[model samples]
Target: MQSIAVSMNLLEFAEPVLIWLALFFFVKSGRVKRFPMMTTYLAVRAASSVILELILNLQRFASVSDTLQNSIYFYTYWAFYISAAISIFFVIREVFLHVSEPVPGIQRFGMLAFNWVAVISGIIAISAALPLKGLGAGMVSIGFQVMRCVSILELCLLAFLALFIHSLGRSFRSLAFGIALGFGLQAGMELITSLIAARSSYLDSSMNIVLQVAITIVLGGWIVYFLSPEPHAEREAITLPVSSPLIRWNEIANALGHSTPHVVVGQSSATFLQDVEKVVDKILTKNSISVNS
Candidate 1:
C-alpha cells in the first residue's frame, strides 16, 4: 500500500511536469506574458510540497504533539490557500483581458476594489497563520477570527468573479477551461474531505501537487497552441478594414456584375452637363432642343 501510494503520487506528478514544460516553452517563446503568474503559482505549490514533507518527517521521524501537528498543518494550509487565492485572481484578470466587450466603466472601478480585497485577503491569511506562538490555540485569537471572516468574504468575491467571466464565454475559452478544472478539483477534494470526516493536514498539500500538474497540462497546452508565433502572426496580419478605401469604391462601381450606376460616357446624352441643362430648358419652355454643338 505504501509503495502503491508513492507510485500513484509519481504518476500524478507527470501531468503537472508536462504542463510546466508546455508553459515553459511558451514563456521562452514570448507566447504568453501571463505565464509568469501561473508559473509562480506552481512554485508556491512546490514550496507547499516541501513544507508538507517537513511536517511529515516531524511526525514520523521526530516526536511532535498532535496540537503542534495541527498548528503546522493550519499554517501550511493557509499558505496554500493564499497562494491559490492570488493565482485565481490572476486567472480572473486574464479572463477580463479577453472579455468579449471592452471593460465596462463600472468594471474598471471594480478592478481597483478587487485588488484591495486581494491584498487584504493575502494579509489576513498571513495573519491567521501567525498563531500566538505558532500553535493552534492562537487561531482562536481575535486576529485569526477576523482574518477567517475576511477570508470568507474573499470566497464570496470569487463567486462574483465567476459570474463576471461567465459573461465573456466566447472569448475566454482557455481560461474558462482552466478555471473549470481547477475549481472542479477543488470542490471535489473539499467534498471528499467533508464526506469522509477525515482530516489530514498533509492530504491537501499532496493533492495540490496533483492539481498543479493537471493545471500545468491543460492551461500550458492551451497557451502554447493559442499563443504560438504562427497563430499570433495570423491574427496580426488580419486586416479588417474599418472603412472602404478609394480602391474599394472603384472596384464596386466599375467592376462587372456590381450594381453601381453605369453611365455610358459618350453614348448616353444624359451623361453631359450641357445635355442636362438643355433638357431642363426644354422642360421649362415645353419645346425641344437640337444638339448642334
Candidate 2:
C-alpha cells in the first residue's frame, strides 16, 4: 500500500508536467490553426488532469470530515470521466477532419458523419450508464462502465480512419493520432483494471496504481510525439476536370465506402475525382512535362 501511494504520487506529479510540455510543443508546431478542435480537446484534458489531481490530494491528506472527503471524491470522479468522454469525442472529430481535408467534398462528408457518430454514440453511452443507478453503485464502477463504452467508440473511429488510409489523400494529424493512441492505451488499461477489480480483491487494491503508471507512460509518449515534427502531408497531384458529375462522384465515393456529404447546389457543388488509372496517367504526364521542360 505504501508503494502504491508512492506510485500514485509520482504519476500525479508527472501528468501535469507531461501535459504542459506537450501543449507547449503542440502550440509551437502551429497545429492550433489547422486543428482547433484537437487543440481545444488537449487543453480541456490537461486542465482536468490537473484539477482532478488537486481534488484527489485534498481527498487524501486534508483534515476534512468523512462526509466532505466523500463529496470531494465523488466530484473528482465525475469531473474526470465526463471531461474525458467529451475530449475523446472532439479528438475523433478532429481526426476525421484531418483525414478528409484534402478533398472538399470528403471533408464535408466526414464532418457530417462525425456529427452523427458523436451524437448517436453519446446517447447510447448515456443509456448504458443509466443502469448503474443507486448510491451503493459507486462512482468508479459507474465511470468505468462509461469508459468502456467510450473506448469502444474510440476504437471504432480509429478503425474507420485506419482502414481507409489508402483511399483518402489526407493523413491523420500528428496531434490527433497521438491523442487517439494515448486514449486507446488508457482505455485498455482501465478495462483491465475493471476486470481485475471484479475478480480479485488483491488486484483490485492495486488497480489504481496500475492505471496511474499506464497514464504516465501514455502521456509521456504523447509529449515525445508532439514535440517531434510530423511528416509532410501526402501529395494530391492529380487534378480532375472542372465539369465532372458531382453526384456521380458522391455515389462512387459511397460505393467505395468513402462518404461524400450532401450539400445544397443548383447544378453543382463539388467536382469528382478521376478514375485511379486516369489520375495516375495525369500525374505521370504532369511529372514528365516538368522533367522535360
Candidate 3:
C-alpha cells in the first residue's frame, strides 16, 4: 500500500515537473510572444498536477481507503482535463493569429463562439466536480458526462479549426502540421474515452497527457520555426513600386483642384492623346493591374 501510494505520488508530481522543466528551457531560448500561450498551458498543467499530488499525499498521510482516494483522484483529474482542453483551444487561436492572414469575419466569429462554449462547458464541469472548494456532490458520473459533451463540442471546433488552417495554404506548414497532429490525437483519445466505460479508460487518460506534451513540444518547435524574425528575407526583398504612375495619379489628383478642366494647355490633339495614354499606362502599372488594351 505504501509503495502504491509512492508510485502515485511520483507519477503525479515528478512527471509534470520534468515535462515542464523541459518546456521551460525549450521556450526560454525563443521569442517572448510565443511563451505566453505555451507557458500558460504548461503552467495550468503544473498547478493541476501539483494539486493532485498534494491531494494524494494527504490521502496517504490520513490513511484514506483506496476507494475514497480513487474517487477524489477521479474528480481532480476531470478538473485538470477541462483546464487542459481550454488551454489547447487557446493555443489553436494563438496559432491562427500568428498566421497573420485574414480569416473570414464569420469564421473569426465562429472561433469566438466556440471559445465561449468551451469556457462555459468547462466551468460547468469544474462546478460539477469540485462544487465549492472541493465540497461537491462527490461522484465522477456527472463530471464525466459533462466532459463527454465538452469533447464533442471540441471535436466540432477542431474540424472548423482544421479548415481554417487548410485555408492558410503552404505558409502555415509547421503550424498546420502541429494543429492536425494535436487535434487528431486529442479527438481520437476523446472518442475512445467516450466509447468506453470510465473505469477502463486508461488509454484516454494516458494518451491525453502524452498528446498534450507532444502538442506543447511541437508548438514550441513551430514557434521557433515561424516566429523567429525573417531578417535575411527582409534584407533581400525588392522595395514596393511606390514610384509607379498609379501612385503619382494620387499626387496629380491632389494637385488638380476639384474644379480642374480636362483641356491640355499647349499641345496638339495627337500629343494630348499620347500623354493620356502614357498616364493610363503608368496608372495601370503602378496599381499592379494588367491592362490588355
lDDT winner: 2
Encode model 1's per-residue lDDT on 171-251: one tens digit a residue.
223433344444444544444554444466656555555544544455555554545444232223223233424235434
RMSD of candidate 1 to true structure, Å: 16.0
Worst 10 residues of 2 by lDDT: 233-242
Worst 10 residues of 1 by lDDT: 231-240
Colliding residue pairs in candidate 3 = none
Q: Candidate 2 deviates by what RMSD?
A: 17.7
Give the TM-score comparing model 1 with the true structure, all chains together: 0.44
**What C-alpha RMSD separates each model from the true structure?**
16.0, 17.7, 16.5
* Per-residue lDDT over 1-293 for candidate 2, one digit per residue giving the tens place of the 0 to 100 score: 78777878888788778777777777887777766766776787778777766766774666787787667767676767667666676776676666655456666766777677667766765566567776435455556555566687677666766665545543454555666677777878877888888898778658988888898898788777777676665333323344545445655555665566889868544345545667889999999999999
Evaluate all candidate structures by whole-model CA lDDT and list the values in order.
0.51, 0.68, 0.55
Comparing candidate 1 with candidate 3, which one achieves the higher lDDT? 3
TM-score, candidate 3, is 0.48
Model 3's lDDT to the true fold? 0.55
- lDDT per residue as tens, model 3, 85-144: 666666655654443233233335546666787677667666666653434453354455
